[model samples]
Target: MTMEIGLNLFSVFKELNEDYFGTLEKVAEMGYKNLELITVNFSTCERYTDTFSLPVIMKKFEDLGLKAFSAHEGVAPGSVIIDADWDRIIEENAELGCQSIVFPMAFISGREDTLQTAEHLNLIGKKCKEAGLSFYYHNHAHEFRRIGETSLFDLLAENTDPSLVKFELDLVWVMRGGYDPLTLLEKLGERCDMVHQKDLGMHVNPVNLFTATPQGTNLDTMKIYTEFVKPNDFVNLGTGIVNFQETYQKLRQLGYIRYAIVENEGQLGIKFTSIESDLKVMEKYVQGL
Candidate 1:
């Protein structure tokens, strides 16, 4: 369970409560030693500003004797969403001292051109490698969706140059996809670099039939995601659903020394104290496992 715990500041993402410093302080208080940050201000597609907030924010972590090991960078919404000026994004990331650039995203349809995705990723990775920065992909459950007995993600992974595209494991989502996270991790081997320690409580909701239906023709919620995990985003580690203790134990047994980032996506809308309680529970459980 104790595998380099870090925090993603993008979680409590609202303009009103942009308490980046307070969030960092809270994470530091809870024994987290690393942080993953997001940089750039996206006012528009044609005209975006590089706030360079990461350098100053990263120093705050350094001041706390913590490492801002990885960053999410300018890639957003979709893992396969290739930026037109990918080099610019990479350059900005290098400027912030981001050791790794993580493409943590939901896979987009028609973006299933694995060859193109691989080319884009490989191109970026080559640059990052040359610049002494690593690159990775963080998965959501949709990455496991298949076409002709092979997943689009698998196709992308298999086709990509190993030296270029490393994986940033998101264990909970992997498990939710009905595949054992470790099995997939081992499948990729050393191409796997970092990890996202999002534990999906204890309940596996049986592939969720309702979420499988078309959006707008919906029966239930109108959350961020068109379908899948947006509804269940509130479930904290080892609590409502996923067996985090056993999962962490298995991960350790497999010799995966990656960061297990605790990301409470959309859970911030709830009681803050309750969220803190869940975090404590996760911390304790991870330590003992």
Candidate 2:
């Protein structure tokens, strides 16, 4: 029931461009055993070290004692869509030594869009499974928008085949989306084997974003509001309102999850110390796990 703590490279994404090897070394020195790599350009399928080949990147990972646990396949021009070249994508990630392929974010306006997205994820998951890798969908607040009585997230979950399409739950987003993180995790059950651990600040305006916006706003419009979110809205783990200790302990009891990756977005800069603090707070929270 123990879980390994790791860092989502997006925490220091910009640092990678300035000094890829150095940044990774610092992360490894910070005691991160795993990393969730971010895709720089989904158009060319470019990652952090675009100039270097996959083998070279793999060597760096081995040298630094960091495992490429998963990657964020973002939504951009020429991104990994339903019609993309799955064979090539799977082959590359498998070669890079990734255990899972995670689609970090998606934008859907309604139930039809949600269902169609689920189908797309299922197909991608099927290919990943065939290639011996798991496929997961990461969530954001937009997913919690309603399509009638059910949230788009629930509709998408209902439509996707559990065996094929899994989930990488993001705790902060669950709270921002107006759902209790624990309740959603309980509902996801075994379908979620990983999570993004970010804290919700005490002063984060309209804590439940759904409450501020119109009840029936579509995801596309909701995305605009999120883009306007201020960087100061996020704070260090323990300083925020999120109950990481309780959440991590519950995940341990669930007994299926193995990795809890800390993600710090829009808070990178001289704030690398904040990420370090976040890790320490998480370590304290899951002391027994």
Top-scoring candidate (lDDT)? 2
Measured against the true structure, the TM-scores of the candidates, in listed sequence, are: 0.79, 0.91
lDDT of each: 0.62, 0.79
Candidate 2 per-residue lDDT over residues 77-97, each given as its tens digit: 334378665677678778888
Q: Cα lDDT for residue 48, model 1?
A: 21
Shift of residue 207 alpha carbon in model 1, Å: 1.7
Which lDDT tens digits does candidate 1 get at residues 1-289?
Answer: 2366676655544321455466667666766676687543333332122332556755776887777678775444443456546677677667656789877663333334656776777877787889888888777666665556776578778877888878887776676555787788778776774666654534446453234545521332223145455545556655566666676676677665667676665453453443465567656755662
Misplaced by over 4 Å in model 2 are 41-45, 77-80, 214-219, 222-228, 266-269
In candidate 2, the residue pairs with backbone N, CA or C atoms under 3 Å apart (3 or more residues apart, or in different chains) clash, namely none
Minimal lDDT window, size 10, model 1:
216-225
